[model samples]
Target: MNFSGLLTLQKERVPLKSIEVELEVRDHVATVVSTLNYENKKNKPLEAVFVFPLPGDAAVCHFSAKIGQTQIVAEVKEKQKAHEEYDDALSSGQQAFLLEESDQSPDIFSLSVGSLPPGESASIRLEYVTELAVQADDGLRFCLPAVLNPPFNPQYKYRGRKCKSFEVVYVPASWLSYSLSFSARVSSPRPISKVESNCSLDPLQYLNTDQTQATVKLAAGHKFDRDVELLIYYKDAHQPTAVVEGGQASAEPGTLMGDPMVMVSLYPEFPETVMSSGTSCGEFVFLMDRSGSMDCAISKSEQEETRMSSARDAVLLLLKNLPMGCYFNIYSFGSSYEHIFPKSVEYSQETMEEALKKVNQMEADLGGSGMLEPLKHIYNQPCIPNHLRQLFVFTDGEVWDTKDVIDLVKKNSDSHRCFSFGIGEGTSSAPINGMAKEGGGHAQFITRSDRMQAKVMQLLRFALHPTVTVTWDLPKEVSVTVLSPPIAILFKGQRSLIYAQLTGQSSEAAEGCVTVKYSLAGHPSENQLHFSLRPAEDTGLTVHRLGARSLFRSLEREEREHKEHEDGGVKEKLVQLSVQSGVSSSFTAFIPVNKDNGDTIQGHFLRRNIPKPCEFTGRNFKW
Candidate 1:
C-alpha cells in the first residue's frame, strides 16, 4: 500500500491507549521512567510500531515490557545485530520488541512490538537519566515531549518507520483520546522555593521541614496537546554545593562505577566592580535558516506566526539593539547560503537599516537546510583585531547531519563563541544545544508560547560581555578527575556542573575544599566550597550512570575526530561502556524477547503505526 493509505488505515486503529510518567530529581540530574500501554483491539494478531521524542542528552538505562503475566527484559546490543535479531524473531513467530534512536535526529526514538496475539496487551516501560538544563531565568527546566512534529527534509532519508518524508499530521491537543499521568519528586541540597509549570499541577508537597525535598504531579485533568514544562526554583539556587555518592557494591573496584564520586555545583558571582565593566567592541554574525520548512506555522493554533516571520522579527530586534561600533554581518541559508554584506561592517544606523531591509524581504524559498558551507565561509574570514567574535544562529534545527555540524562548530570554537536559538516546536535539541556546548556559549529555545523579544534581548545582554572563565584547585592527595566538561565560560547566576571521581581514600571526617577563582572585567574573584569526604548512601547507581554517560559523550567526540585514523577502537570502547553501564547510545539498541511456547500462528499478522496526538489545523503539517 502507498504511504498515505497506510497512514489512513493506522489512524483508524490506534494502538496506544495511555501513558504514565514518574520522575525523580536528585540535585541537578533527573531520572525519568515512562510507561506506555498498548492493546491489540483488532480481531487478529498484529505488530505495532510507535515513535516518540526524548531529550537528546538522555541516557536510557532500562527498557522492558510486560505481556499478559510475563515480564520480558530488554538487553543492549549493537544496532544492526539487534535489528537482525528482531527481524528473525518476527519471522519465526516469536514475540519481540525493538527500540532504537533515530539516525536523523537525536531527540526522536522508534519502538516496534512484534507478534502480539489477538486481544493481548503490552505495557512497555523505559527509564532514562539526564541533567536538567538551566533556563535563561535561572530556573531548572524539565520538558516532557507531547509532540514529535517531523521536520521537512526532502534531501534526507527518513529511517524511522512512522513518517515517509518527515510529514506528521497535526492533531489538536484538546482532541487527545488517551490520558497522561505524570509525577515528579525533587530533592536538592538547597531549600525548595516553588515549582511552576505551563500545565496545571497539584500543590507541592514537602517531604521535610527544611523543604529540601518536594513532590509535584500533573493535575487530574490536563490536555496532552503541548509539551509539559516544569520550571523549578529553589532557595539560594545560585549557591554552590558539593555532593559525594558511594560506589555501587555489585560493580568491580577501581572502575568508574566502582569508585566514589563527587559532584560540585558552581554558581560564579563576580563583584559589582567586575559586573559593571563591558566590552567596547565585538564581531557579531547572525546566521538564519530560510529553509522551506520555515513556512510552517509556529503552532497548530497559530497559523499567522510562521517560523520565518518570527526569526525575522528576532533578527530585527537584534540588529536594532546591537552595540554601537561593533562589527556585524547577516547570513541566511536554505538549499544554499547568502550574506548581506561581503565583510563585517560596523554597527551603524545606515548599516542596520540596510540589513533590516534585506531581512524583512527574505522568504523561506530555500530548498533545504544546509549549514556547513555558510559556517565555513564565516570561519574562513579574517578575525578583526580587538573584537570578541560571537556567532548567533537561529533555526528550526531540521538538519539531518547533526554530528558533522557539531564537529565543525567544535573545530572552530576557538575562533568564535556560538549562541543558538531553536525557533519551533520539536526542534532538534542536538544541534542547538550541541553547538552551544562545543562553541562555549548558551542555548535558548523560542516556542509559540514564548516571547521572541525577551529571549532575543537575553541573548543580546549575554553577548555584550565576554564569558567569565573559572578555575579551581582541589586537595593534592585526592587526585580528582573531572568527568564532565571543563569550565570554559561562566555566566553570572548560571549553574556550572563539575563531576569527578575521588580516587584516593580519605578519612570519613576529612573535609575537602574547592576554591573557584575567575576573572571578570579584569577583576579576579574567588568562592570557596567545602564538602565532607564521607560518601552518602548508595543512590542506586544514578551518579555512576551519569558519569558513564559523560564519559561516553567525550569518547564519541574523540571517535569523530579520529574517524580517519582510528581502527574501530573507539567503537569497541563505546560498546563496552554501553553494555557495562546499561545505557543506550548511538551504537547500541534495546531488544526484548518473548520465549513463551504458545502455538505459533501460521497466518500473517498486520502491522500498525500508532500516532501520537499533536496540535494540528486543517492544513497538513509539512515539517
Candidate 2:
C-alpha cells in the first residue's frame, strides 16, 4: 500500500489505547517504567510497527508483554539472532515483540508487535535508567517526549520514494483517543527544595518531615503538544555525595555487573579571587548550521521564532559581548561551509559590527546537513599564540557520520575546547553531547520556550573561565578503577559525575575518603567526601547498569576508531556485557516470544505500519 493510504487507515483505527508512566528518582539517577496498551479492532491478525524516541544516554534494561493471562519477558541477544527468532515465532502463529535501537541515532527506537490477533489486547512494558542532567540553575532535568500528540515523524526514504509529510497537529490531552498518566517519586540525601514542570502538576506532597522524599503527579486535562519536563531542586545541591551499590548475584564474579560500583558526584569550587578575575584573552570560533531544517519554527507555537532567526540573534549577542582584543571568527555550514575571515581576527568594534551584519542577513538556503568537513577545516587551522582556542557549534539536525565527527574532535581536543548547542525539538542528542564530551566542553539544548541568548551567554562564561585539571585520591587500601573517561572540562557550580569500581575490602565501621584536587588559574584547590565503606543495602543495580553503559560507549568508540587494526574482540565484549546486564545496545536487541502452543491458528498475518506523529516541518531527513 502507498504511504498515504497507510496513514489514512491508521487514523481510522488507532491501536494505541493509553500510556502510563511511573518515574522514580534517587538523587541524580532516575528509573522510569512505561506501559503501553494496544487493542486490535480489525478482523484479521496483524503485525504493527511503532517508532519512538528516548533519552540518548538511557539504558533500557527491561521489556515484556502481556497477552490476556500469558506473560512473556524479553532477553537481550545478538541483533541478528533476535531478528531471526522474532520471525520464526511469527511464522509459527505465536505472538512476538521486537525492540531495537535505530542505526542512525541512539535516541530513536523501533518496536514491532507480530501476530496480534483481532479483538485481542496486549500490554507492553518498558523500563530504562538515566542520569538526570544538571540544569543551569542546579535543578535536575528530566524530559518525557510527547510522541503521541504531534508524533515523532522522522523522515526516511521508503522504496525510493519520499513519504507524505503531515503538518503538526495539536491534539489536546482530553481530545486524544490515547490517554497519558504520569506520576513521579523523588528521594535525595539532601532536603528537597521544590519541584517544577512546564505542564500542569498537582501540588508536591512530602513523605517525611525532613523533606528528603516526595511525590508528584501530572494534573488532569494537561496538553500533550509539548514534552513533559521536570526540574527538581534540592537544598545544598553542590555538596559532594557518593553512592555505592553491590553487584548482581546471578552474574559472573569478574563481570561488570557482578562487581561493586561507586558513583561520585562532585561540584568544584574555585577561590574567590580567581572566580572574580575572569580571563580576557581567548580565541573564539563560532560555527552555525544553515541547513534547510533551520528554517522551521523553534517550537510548535503559532508565532514562535524560526530556529535560524534564534541562532542568528544568539550569535549577534555573543559578538556584542565578546571581550576586546580577543581573537575570533565566524563560520556557517550546510552542504558546504563559509567563513567570514580567512583566519582568526582580533576582536574589535570593526570586526564585531562586520560579523553582526553578516549574521543578520544569513538564511537557511543550504540543502542538507554536512558538518564533518567544516569541523575538519576548523580544526586544521593553527592556534593563535597565548590564546586558548574555544569552539562553539550550533545545529538543529543530525548528521550521518556522528562517530567520525566525534573522533575528529577528540584528536584535536588538546588545542581547543568545544561547546555545542542543539536547537529545536527532535534534535538528536547523541552527536550534540558526544562532540562536547570528546572535545572537553559543554553541551546545551534550546527548546521551544528557551531563550537562546541566555544559554549561549552561560556557555560563554564557562569558556572564559580558566581551564582546570583533576586528580582523584582514595584510601590506600582501596583502589579505584575509573569506568568513565578522564575529566576533560570543569565549570563552577556544575556537577561532574565519576563512576568507578572499588576493589578490596574495608571494615563496616571504617570511613573511606575521596578527594578531587584541581588547579584553577595557577591556584590549587580540593573538595573531599567521606562515606562508609560498606555498600548501601536495598539499592538496585542502577549503578552497575549505568557503569556498564559508560563502558559500552567507550568501547564502541574505540572499536570504530580501530576498525582496521582490531579483530571481532570489541564487538564480542559489547555483546557479552549487554546480554549479561540486560541492557540494550547497538549490537543487541530485546526479543521475546510467547511460545504457548495452545490453540494455534494456521494463517498468514497482514502487516500494518502504525504512523507516528511527525513534527510540523517539511525538511528532508537522512538516515
Candidate 3:
C-alpha cells in the first residue's frame, strides 16, 4: 500500500502557519526560544503529529503550549511513561502534548498535539540552549534548520514491504504560508566586528559604546527555502576567554547543576609552518555514496543541482588538487562498492584524467545507501608508508545504524584520520559529526548556496597538516574535566572548549590559573590562562547547562561502546540530569496535559503528519 493508505484521516487542516525565533547570545552560549503557531481548522477534535528538526547538541530546557486562554507547561518523564500518559489523556478527552527525539536521528523530533477542538488555535513554545561552534573563518555560526531532507528508508524481508523508491518533490519557499521572524541580542567580552547571514537581515543595533553588545533581526521579507545561517565576527576572535557561572538556587548542592561551573575556550596559536609545510605527501581516500536517493535535488527549488551531480563535481575538484607524489584512490558505494583502481595509485596527470572520465560517467544507480561493508573494505587495506592516511567521506548521510559506523571509525582512528562531508540539506548530523569526532577530524556541511570548493579545500588543508594535542594542568584543590572526551586533534582556527565543575570553594581573594600544554611541529609549547575565583554577575547558568550536556554525551558514548545500556547508574544519572536541568536526553521526554474541560472527544482519531518536500525528488513523502 502507499504511504497515505497506512494512515486514516478523519479531519484535516493546516498544522503550522508561522515560526517566531528569539535568541540570546552571551559570550559563546546561545539560548533560543521558538514559538510555532498552529491552527486546527478541522470540523472535529483531532490530533496533529508534527515532525521537525533541531541542532543535535541543543539542550532542550522547556516545552509549553497555549490553547484558548489556558497555558499548559510540560513535565519531563521517562519516554515510555510519557507516551502512556499521553495516550491515557487523549482517551479521556483531555488535551495533551508529547515531544520526543527520534531513535535513529537525534536531530529529528516529533511533537504530538492531541484533542484539539475544532476552530481553536494552539501556540507551541520550545526553548533550548546550545554551545555555538566556531567556524573556520574565526566567526561563530548559527543555523536555523528549515529543510527536512528525506532519508533513504529500506524494507526488510521480515516486513514484506515493497522495495520501491520514494520520491520527495521540491517546493519553493514562496509556497510556505508565512515567513520566519528571528531576532537575537548578542553580548560578548570582546568588541563586535560584524554580522553576516545567508538571508537578509536588518542593520545591527549596538547596545553600548564599547561595542560589546548588539541586537539584530531578520528582514521582513525572507524566503525560508533553506537553512538560515548567521556568521558573527568579533574583534580578536582567536583570543582565549573563560566564563564562570553560578549554579541554580533551586537545585540541590553538589549536583551537576547545583555547583558553580567554569567554561574555558582556547584557540591555540600554532606556528604558521605547522599548517603549511605538511602538504608534501599523504594517502587520500575518497568514499562517495551513489544511492538512488542521491538522484534528488539538494534545494527546495528544482532548478538546483542533484546530490549525485554535486558529489561528482566535488570529487573532480579534489582529484585535480591532490598533491603530487601522494597516494590517492576513489570508491563509489551504494549496495556495493567499486573502486577506480584496485589500490591507491600515485597522483599524476594520467590518474587524474582517468578518474575524471569515470566520475563523469557515474550515476545514482546504487540500490541502497548501506555504507558499512564499503567502509570495512576501505579499512581492511594496508596504509602506505611515509604518508599520512586521510579518509574523506561524501554522502547524504541516511544510514540506519549510525552508531555502528561511528564505532568502526573509532576502532580504526589510530590508523587514519577521517573527514566527513554531509551533502545536501536534511542530512543526519549524528553520523557526519560522530565520524569526525571519533575519527579525530572535522565535519563539513554543503548546502545549495554553500561553495563545495571552499569546504573541500578546507578539509584538504586540515588533512595535510598536523594538529596539536592539548592538555590542561589544574591546581591540586581544583580539578578540571571535560564533558566530552579529551582533545585528540587541535586544528588551526578551531576553538578548544572545556567545561568543568569547581567542587572545592576558593577564596575570593585567591586567583585561579590553568596551564595548557601542547606539542606543535614535534616541539613543546605551553600557555597560561588565569581568572578570578569570584563569580561574575550571575548569568542564567548557561555554562552549567552546557557542561551538563557535555557530561551526558560522554556517558552516552561510554554506554554505547560498552553496550552496558545503563550500567553503573549511567542511565539513571542521565534521567536525573534531564529532569533537574530541564534538558531532554535519550531517556527522557516532555509531556504536557491540558486540564481544560472540553467535549470528551474520544474515538478513532485520525493522524496526519505535515509532509515535507524531498530534496531527491520534488514529490512529498510522509514518514
Quote the lDDT for 254 in model 1: 73
- TM-scores, one per candidate: 0.87, 0.88, 0.86
* lDDT on C-alpha atoms for all candidate structures: 0.73, 0.73, 0.71
lDDT by residue for model 3 (171-282), tens: 5455666557899989887899999987889999999999989999999887666677888888888777777787788977677787778788876545567756545579
Cand. 1 Cα-lDDT: 0.73
lDDT of 2 by residue, 300-386 (tens): 652357677778877888898888779999999866789999999999889888898899998766545678898889988999988
Model 2, position 135: C-alpha lDDT score? 66
- Better candidate number, 1 or 3, judged by lDDT: 1
- Between prediction 1 and prediction 2, the one with superior TM-score is 2
Best by the TM-score measure? 2
CA lDDT of 266 in candidate 2?
Answer: 74
Query: Best-fitting candidate, measured by lDDT?
Result: 2
User: Scored by Cα lDDT, where does model 2 land?
Assistant: 0.73
- TM-score of decoy 1: 0.87
